[model samples]
Target: MIEKLAINGGKPVRDTYLAYGKQYIDDDDIKAVVDVLKGDYLTTGPKVKEFEDTVANYVGAKYAVAVSNGTAALHTACLAAGIGEGDEVIVPPITFAASSNCILYCGGKPVFVDINPDTYNIDVEKIEGAITVRTKAIIPVDFAGQSVDMDLICKIADKYNLTIIEDAAHALGSEYKGEKIGSIADMTEFSFHPVKPITTGEGGVIVTNNEELYKKMLLFRSHGITRDSKLLTHNEGPWYYEQLHLGYNYRITDIQCSLGLSQINKIDEFVKNRREIVNRYNEAFKDIEEIITPREDEFSNSGWHIYVIKLNLDKLTCTRKEIFEALQVENIGVNVHYLPVYLHPYYEKLGYKRGLCPEAEKLYERMLTLPLFPKMTDKDVEDVIRAVKKVVDYYSMENCPL
Candidate 1:
């Protein structure tokens, strides 16, 4: 009843994981990176700037600042958005930790909000209830590559004078109301980790249309060293630079940017493949009463970064853990997308308690991400379908189906 995965199953899980998520690399992706390696600049250089522009143009943003990693992008966005000590940032509990961690980095407290189980997004209706004088911003995570209800979230932010920096790490190719995820949010952060829709090996970028924030992000990307002389009052010398504020060394290298550029070319291809896989999974699970499948809203299109399934806990004859373990025994590797951020011991020790976000806690009890990636083939898809079916049938409370 609690979980379907059996930990002590007396069987090895996977010699090599059919990981819940992973990256795909081709010869061309390799060649572009090699070309950068052969070039003169490796660290934050011309290619990094080029990569920023490429992403900006693709997402319809005025500026993009490439950073060392996704967490860095979130941290920089937090600072640029004017979040700091004594501020309270509203965020949903159904997200990866960095969404809240970024707020803490600015000495701000993250106010956890529950999500709408249907879309698995931060419930915009709950925003007004969470807001207080200390509130600084609202970070709505686009869970599973589906853009959160941005229009409503923005409307609430406008009323409260709060910033909305979308935690769009999983939404590169996702769209909301036909507008790209990156373009609609006041500020959106993207990850180019290998497992993401686009891979830069390990990199992230912040995209925005606000000019003042753009400059601040540029300065923050490289240890707060502003080389532009026009902004400074005194011209010390041609080589002079100023550490305008306490920033970080969160710059992305040209080598990574080269990989990103190459990956950009295949983004549409990757997205198409992921969509096909999700469709396959949807059809395979359509009639199974024991499991509830993923739901795609009529208004939004997901990049399908993850094909997460929430178990019909009330219907399943077997525990959630048993199903997970059953699949693992057959080498059909599966993983959970998250344990609610507030459920983590660190969050609990920080005074966050259970029931703070009831819906998210209930969701964490059953949410599991199935294997999904651009590289999956027909055989791989069948393997997963067969594994899940076998597990369900074998554990049926009724007589097993043939």
Candidate 2:
């Protein structure tokens, strides 16, 4: 029905708008939440523990602690790692601000590390040069569902005596070298946001094999208060409790955990479908010179949260914004994954400046996230591909100079 590109006064790809990511809730998910609502315990209840145990088992971790959300998981992990004032944490600049903000939350300084231009993860080689006596930990993000090189990162941590808290917020189903993500890092954090591999409305969990860190994080999520018999110094009566340390009210609700338990049952299917969509996108755009599809390391089996495309500016007549807006004009709801974390005004106020991570800053200029969710039908996927091709073709330059 369409003869020309929408950006050039032609018909658009589709009549409806498609977002980059979305939740796929079904009848089972609904029943789980409804069942929780009708149950006795609502807040800190049995379902939370069940969900935590299930996730821990799923990821091969010894313990798991469910928290209110992803940021809380990061904060709790930071506290468990002993981050505090005068401490420094190494993190990639090419990720969500929460990855770095978690360090700030713990009274520690966030040292911005550049990304690998090929994989868009933190450059592990650059991490060593950034380390100092104050450096306490490294928060390596599994950006866009791909796992980082944990084997090499572990060696770095061992040499420097630094902790590793994997911000695997996008990588619940991802794997590294045939091993699952949660079991690979010292402590791994997962998000259960609607847009993630699974949904819990708003929830997060931290998993670890270390019993000490697990115990520390458990208390940290509950206002530093405990009523446990072993933890209490003086059990004057059944009601007696103690505040072990300064912590936060980061506990997740049973309702969310109920939804999470249901969601985890279908995580495999969710990840498989996401991979199929990514494959389709890659094949569709393979011959398009103006676009470069995302790449994963050979060791990474990505969970495929979002599929991003990088623009070849020299080969395109239009700018990155032009291509992004043109896609929007064609009913494609594309987005940018992130701007460099330190580039935000708040980070600038904290005394960070430009030229901190040149690769990340450059990546921001060309990156554009496309629509990719498990709920998308075949037609929806085709519509996105057509929309992208139309926009790129309209703006492409055959012989532009770099």
Best by lDDT: 2
Model 1 per-residue lDDT tens digits across residues 151-266: 78888988889999999999898888887779877789999888899999899999999889999998888888887988876788998888888999998899999999999989
lDDT by residue for model 2 over 1-402, one digit each (tens)? 224667667778888888888999999999998998999988899999999999999999999999999999999999999999989999999888999999998899999999998889999989999999999999999999999999999999999999999999999999998877899778999999899999899989999999999999999999899998988988899878899999899999999999999999999999899999999999999988888889899999998888888998988887899889888889999999899999999999999999989999999999999998887999999999988877777677853232
lDDT of 1 at 94: 86
Candidate 2: segments with Cα more than 4 A from true spot: 1-4, 399-402
lDDT of 1 at 373: 92
Worst 10 residues of 2 by lDDT: 393-402
Cα lDDT of candidate 2 equals 0.92
Measured with C-alpha atoms, the lDDT of residue 62 in candidate 2 is 95
Per-prediction TM-score: 0.95, 0.97
